[model samples]
Target: MQINTIYTRSVIQTMAGKAIRDLRSGGERELRNVAELCKGCSASPGYQTFWSLLENILRRPDQQYAALLSRAANDVDINCLKTLIANLGLHAYPNGSQPLPGTRESGTSPSYWMEPLDDIMDPRMLHQQISRLQKQGTSSFLFRAGQKPELETILNIAGKHRQCVFFLICGAESCCRAYLEEMTALGNVIPLMEYETLAPTAASLKQAGILFGLHRRYCEIESLQAEENLLRQCIALGCFLGVYEGSAQCPSQNWELACYSRLQEMRCNGAQEIFLADLWRDREAVQKLLEQRSGQV
Candidate 1:
């Protein structure tokens, strides 16, 4: 049943990707229902179009996230916002407990993330990183907890710190069921199913030659009816929900369709604490747009 759910999710994700590729091709033929389909492709549900996504993520915020972060000093405020954080990797801090000292995401200053050690037996680096982030008053931490050791580090850190350690489960391909099971056991380490990486869906679509390939992919899938099962699994396992974001080098269409599908399905399945990676720096605007559109809907 779980395997079938994973396949359906993959196929739906592929459908969205094909839609994005069609829009990006810029041919008039691509406009045949592509624009309409592409509306929810780049951003979350109800974002409506690529323009809507860009306006929210690329443009200035309707409300300042920096101010939001400052005001989110207390535990209540942090909990209200879900204490979201993202992409705090080992490379982010090279010299010391900082993000390589002088880059866009500097280490000397209060950083947005704190990552743990990647090695199975060694979580020392992660501990150091968390300590530094803690000193800077960070309330949240991001970790790629796809593996057992990595998850263990998160649990250890969560036990030691009062902060929220947000776990990004990359994909079912890379993560095992045990990851969620153990994470649920912890009861505090946040379990998050990742979104925002639309490349795989797009690739499947491209390879499947758009709709033609999608149909073929569907034939390979076990069932489509099981799409929402994973969300229920995550929710039942105590997942808080999380997503990734693309860079300026990446396109909005790359993520829209698949994420939109997941977001809608997640909502239908009762996911309430969804969060965007890169923290809210890139997500707040789109989230506001989604809220506004949902209201109108």
Candidate 2:
């Protein structure tokens, strides 16, 4: 069944790619009718939304950030998205839906830092740790490392665990062009780099077909226009998502909610792919959103 689903998705993506090429060449065909595509593809809302989004972007070329959305439609890996829908969709609902028995508490085991010398630095130990997480029904993880070589080793290990998704918290220097290419090919390990540090290299990195998100600290907005400008710049540079880190500077609950609201606004306006994940403050809401998108009750 999995093989058949994969094959169906491959065909769908091929058709989308052809449509993109034809649209570029002044052909009249446009991407539409996602419900038709979903006939035998899958019942998952995530898959349906994915196709609908592609259709909307291609059909309305005059919308805001159309060029960036077009580039994303071309560069983003459909296989990776399918993997997320299949694996994280299962992980999102823990009512006996996970493939493995519980080995740790849900939600807490998904993110990690480079502590525990053996688990992250040693390849064998890292593999063992990931295997344990997999057994614990943890399908996604966020990892941080101190050095470039350590980051490389982590990506290598993550590629071996293709069933799971990994997020690497990286600095600008750590995410070079070659590293971006490696991550792109892996189709699972996503890098979340500090926005200020990566802005200069965003265009070059985008050209390399790298899939990544920018990490920014949330604070009281001094100028809403400036914030929108930054978002437009990020999207124009081909960023598919945003990872907003909660800051102690913004202590008011109202302020935090406001920040999330702004992200939600951006998501609804034109950049549906711009995901804001605040692991420190609102993990539950994030999980619920994932579960909802995955079509799990």
The candidate scoring highest on lDDT is 2
- Show how many residue pairs clash in every candidate, following the order shown: 8, 0
- Model 1 scores a C-alpha lDDT of 0.36
Q: What is the lDDT of residue 120 in candidate 1?
A: 33
Q: What would the per-residue lDDT of candidate 1 be over residues 199-272, giving only the tens digit for each residue? A: 23323222222110000111122333353453334323323333433344444453443554554453333233
Cα lDDT computed for each candidate against the true fold: 0.36, 0.58
TM-scores of all predicted structures: 0.35, 0.66
Candidate 2 lDDT (Cα, 0 to 1) = 0.58
lDDT of 2 by residue, 1-297 (tens): 255434544455454455445434442243233223432343445445655665565465544434444455567665544444344433322232333332245544432211122345788887888777665445677777668878878888878887667777778765677877777677677777777766787766666656678777767345557766776677767787777767666556676678777776665455443554565555554443444433443
lDDT of 2 at 192: 74
Top-TM-score structure, candidate number: 2
